[model samples]
Target: MGITGTRQAYEFPAGGAPPLGEVRAWLRQQLSDVGRGTMADTELLTTELVTNAHEHADGVAELRVSVASDRDVVRVEVDDRRPHLRPRRVTKQDPTTPHGRGLALVEAISTEWGVATGTEYKTVWAEIPVL
Candidate 1:
């Protein structure tokens, strides 16, 4: 992990998601100014993005977590080598199942979110407002 200004990034050589607990703790530490509610939302959304990339986009290549200079939002991005894969929201969810609800949680909680693709990688990102 490296930090500069308001941003911190982690690069994974093994090409997979890092442990969710570690990521959440890192994010929480970065967000000292935010309330517990905002921190929870950020953690949950970041976990969803990372988990989705690991499961669907081959694996995660990097994870970037940044807070706006003005502290208006915290943005979490998960990058993967597979540029062809993108996140999709599941319209129909089964009550008994634990899968297929990540993107839906992202959509509901993130203030803004989207994907960016390069020649060899795609980054799925979400921004949660600081409250």
Candidate 2:
């Protein structure tokens, strides 16, 4: 027998902040039957990616999540209208600087992550081993 799962898509307004608690709760529910280790990383990475989209993008952002057991991977992609402003590794002298840590956190937590650019938008995506 094979394990089965699904994918979901969500759209967030341009420059609009998503309620962190609500998003986290929704993810918890979605991955309720999965193991704790997978769920923890998924939630954290999702929050970071979505928050980054809201902060940096000029127009609406979209989130797509896919859960699949065959591949034993949970994938998340956050799409934003600003393709030019790709996430970069910044070395900041002031640790007190309010921004620039999102990608670092994502890189730390996810198994693999990268960026894809289209003419109209860009997507930052991460994948975690779910099995």
Candidate 3:
């Protein structure tokens, strides 16, 4: 069955953001109807975005996952409090360092991705095509 019009939103709690594993689990459950490969790709990209938000922007304000009407793509968006810090892919990554590879991974795997800046927050979104 297709997941058209299916959407889920997660707002960060007051205490702290949920564990990355929990987020992945939730996403896996939500996208279970998609192919395994597609679900894995979505989890990886979603984790990257959530990790970036926690590491760079203090914390994530919300997370949204939605399937397009045509069921051709899944969109994952992570919103953070810092509007000025837009995500960008690292052109030159250092093998020695573990930092700065998140956006690069997102760029490589996502069919299309971009940042949306609100007055008080910014959202990094990626679209993964369903295979």
Candidate 4:
């Protein structure tokens, strides 16, 4: 049996932080049939991507969570109206910086993650294996 499901679009104000707890709870309920570890990781990565969109971009932000058992992966994407702020891997020498560590954490946890840019918006996405 293969699992495949997707949640409806969630829209939030740009540069405005959404409640992480609420998002996690909703995701938990949606993915209840899925494994707990995979669900937890997906929720954490989703929060990171969404938080980045809210803090760094402007206009509006949207989120989508998709699970594909055939592909053995769960993907989370955060879309923002601003396409100018490209997502990049930060290489910081000083560890004392007050900010700029989100991408690093995302990379450390997710199996793979990157940005997809379109004509009007950009989506930062991360995928974690469900095995």
Candidate topping lDDT: 3
Residue-wise lDDT of candidate 4 within 76-96, one digit each (tens)? Answer: 888888887897788864689
Assess every candidate by TM-score.
0.87, 0.83, 0.92, 0.85
- Candidate 4 — which pairs collide? none
**Candidate 4 vs. true structure, TM-score:** 0.85
Off by over 4 Å in 3: 1-3, 15-17
Off by over 4 Å in 2: 1-5, 13-15, 91-93
lDDT of 2 by residue, 47-74 (tens): 8888887777754477777876777788
lDDT, model 3, position 12: 74
Clashing pairs in 1: none
| lDDT of residue 14 for candidate 4 | 38
lDDT of 1: 0.81
**Cα misplacement distance, residue 61 of candidate 1 (Å):** 1.0
lDDT of 1 by residue, 1-131 (tens): 12224567876658444687877877777676778898899889988888888888787888888877565777888898899876777898899997999999999999889999999999999988877
lDDT for model 3, please: 0.86
By the lDDT metric, which is better: model 1 or model 2?
A: 1
Ranking by lDDT: 3, 1, 2, 4
TM-score of 2: 0.83
Comparison by TM-score, 2 against 4, better one? 4
